[model samples]
Target chain A: MTIRIAAVGDIHLSEHARGTYRAHLDGIDERADVLLVAGDLTRHGTVEEGQVVVDEFRDLGIPVVFVLGNHDYHSDAEQEIAAMLRTAGMYALDDSAEVLLDGRLGVAGGKGFGGGFAGKCASEFGEPETKAFVRHTREIADRWRIALKGLDTDHRIVLSHYSPVKETLAGEPPEIYPFLGSYLLAEAADAAGADLIVHGHAHAGTEKGVTPGGIRVRNVALPVLGRAYAIYCLGGEEL
Target chain B: MDIWDPPHYVAARVQRAIAEDERTNELGIRVDIRGDHLFLQGQVCEEDQRERVAQVAAEAAPGMVVHNEVICVAVGEPGEQEVL
Candidate 1:
């Protein structure tokens, strides 16, 4: 069975974001089996802003799966925003996956992270606040690793908000390299094994790469240099 | 009006000093210029944030110099480039 997933990210909408995606996603049902958002749905982490995105997703006749982006945490009201998105018939995944409506494909997901590359990364046992940041990304990595490991499907796909390898950080300046993608995410994908890994958050970064283990990676940040969405095939189980 | 002076009163005198401190020193970051002079003082996250603050400050003051005192707070540690 073949499945087509419509995906995009970094909508960055606020209460004023109502008109943003509806016009774009109105014909979604005819597009694919599921809609995947790689994160940054709300601009300031406001529930009202998330609600705006949620309201727009109501136009979809298929399942919508997504991971929360850093912008979604700007406000402490993340739970409220998650609740609102859930109420709008979207599945909010963080290192988790669900059997796609077709059942042959399992979509695993996580928000992933940004810590540059392996040479420069934050250790979890640092200052209290610093520790929190490092630990958070580690947690994101570990959870995704586990979630992907747990899935049993004909086709496995991973969705993330942060780029997984340096290969995707092409156009971005070297000074800002670490901010665009994280090696931990690539590490996790390699260990768990996946067919296709989709992500965003590298607005200036390139759009493709591979884990050391050779799993395919795709970056879909809307403002990134190329196409808004990537179309791939799940007809064969390569792994 | 309120005695809550936004730590930027001394911004003009402390750009390098603030930029060297582990918590507030930065290289390519932009600073915001709000609640004060065309030059604003604040702690931003990344160089992008700094650049953004500078852009906003400049637009806010078309002719005046938007003195940038916005220090980039290294979320992790120094000797490092980013904390994101």
Candidate 2:
């Protein structure tokens, strides 16, 4: 059976965004089997902002899974944000995997960091600060790989907040590539043989791309999609 | 006569301009200088805000070319409404 996934990211929900999404997201459960929020669920990582996002999805009646974004860490309340979402019946994953649809689909998620792409990326061989910066991404990428490896479902979906490949980040400025995402996340997903990869964080990026292993990568940032959400039917059509 | 580094001077001027502007201050715009070029990067809520930010940067750095990399997001109106 094909699993319909409705995904979007970078909602950046704030206090003012309390009721903005419900109207746009109405009937999502009837449209898709599951909802995947790629990240940036809050504007500044406040519990109140997180509450706004949770309120929108509280009665969506579908399994909602999400990862945290860089913006969600702005106020250092990421833990509270995740807790708020979880309390509202959403699965907030960070370097973890969850099986859904009665073991039909497995989602591996991580708030992937940025360190540029291959051939022009940063390395851990530089100064202490540079090493730490690159190392953080490396750790998250490694966790992502491990999480995907642990999934035992029929379809594997890798979800993240940062773009895994440069293909989806096309419209974003090339100078900010290092800060937009890292290629390591792509390598991990490709090696793990994912059916689909969903991410956000690149607002100016394109919507679609492919991994080296031919897995489909999508940037579902709200601005890029030009809609409240997008539905992608995985395992039904060959990409 | 006071000597000024073109890029640094432009960066400082643009920073002050953005900070002093009510409409752009909360946008968190970042200014970078490369030689005589000034790069503005950030997200603004509206199209006019993007233009305003670029215009402010250009005016702050008169002789430098401004590269406006600011992205404008069309966020819908925010208010309380009945949940469906």
Candidate 3:
């Protein structure tokens, strides 16, 4: 069977652009079977923003799989937003996994960590504050790795808001690499053997690449760079 | 011996494709493709649009397995970003 996956990330929608997905979503018909968002659905994480996101997905042709970003919890209303998202039929994943494309696709979601980028990333061997940052990122990576391993489907996709590898982050400045992404996340995806991984957050980074394990990775931050959504297919004889 | 066989695995060709990628002055889609796998690398204009690039590249490969790893590089700093 041919399954099309359409994904985008970092679409910072607000009350003004409520239901923004209503218009451009038509591409889904000619494009994909499910939608994967790479986080940052709101200008400021709030129930209102979550509602807007939910409303936008109300018309999506297929199931919507999503993960939250730092912004999604800006107001510390992550739980409220997550609840409303579930009510709206949107899977707001947080260190979680779900089936999509009518169970043809196995997807895991996590907000991810930003201890910077590869070669310039953070380590867990510093002071309390520094160790906490590095360890925190490690925790997220560990959870994501566990979730990816738990997926039982033909094609597994990991959704995150931060990057996992430097190959995918060619354009971001080296200095801010630590806060932009980390090699740890990619390590998790690699170890878990996921088929593909998608993320946002590095708006200045490039748009395509791979993990050391050769799993696919894409950065889908909308505001910083975008034209429309992307479409990819899997589990076919052609591939 | 086959324990490490990859999904849509085409190790031989992907290595050659990436090696040739260094010669391109323009962002050519064919070179960006690995083996039969596709990876969208380099700078892009906006966030979500990077998705389209991957789609187009995959479509161009016609049955080649695709693995999108496209990151979104901001065009400018946060507030400095104006209507482009």
Fnat values, one per model, are 0.00, 0.04, 0.00
Off by over 4 Å in 3: A223-225, A237-239, B1-84
lDDT of prediction 2: 0.82
Q: What is the clash count of model 2?
A: 1
For A1-239, candidate 3 gives per-residue lDDT tens digits of 86776777877665656754567665465556788888877756778878888888765767888888877877789888888888877788898899776667899868888786556667778589999999888998889888888888878888998888776667666666777688888898889888778888776677677888898787767633454566666666432
Best by DockQ: 2
What's model 3's overall lDDT?
A: 0.69
Pairs in steric clash, model 2: A116-A178
Write model 2 residue lDDT over A34-146, tens digit each, in one string: 99999888766777888888888887888999899987887788988888888887899989999999999999977999999999999999699999999999998889889
Candidate 1: where are CA atoms >4 Å away?
Answer: A125-129, A225-228, A236-239, B1-55, B59-84
Tens digits of per-residue lDDT for model 2, B1-84: 988656666687788898576434432477999887789887754466678788888877788889999887754322221110
**Where does candidate 2 stray beyond 4 Å?**
A237-239, B1-84
Error of 2 at A6 (Å): 0.6
Q: Write the per-residue lDDT of candidate 1 for residues A99-149, one digit (tens) a residue.
A: 877667788877777766887776777589877766777888888888888
Q: Candidate 1 on B12-44: residue-level lDDT in tens?
A: 333443334323233223334355455555444
lDDT of 2 at A170: 94
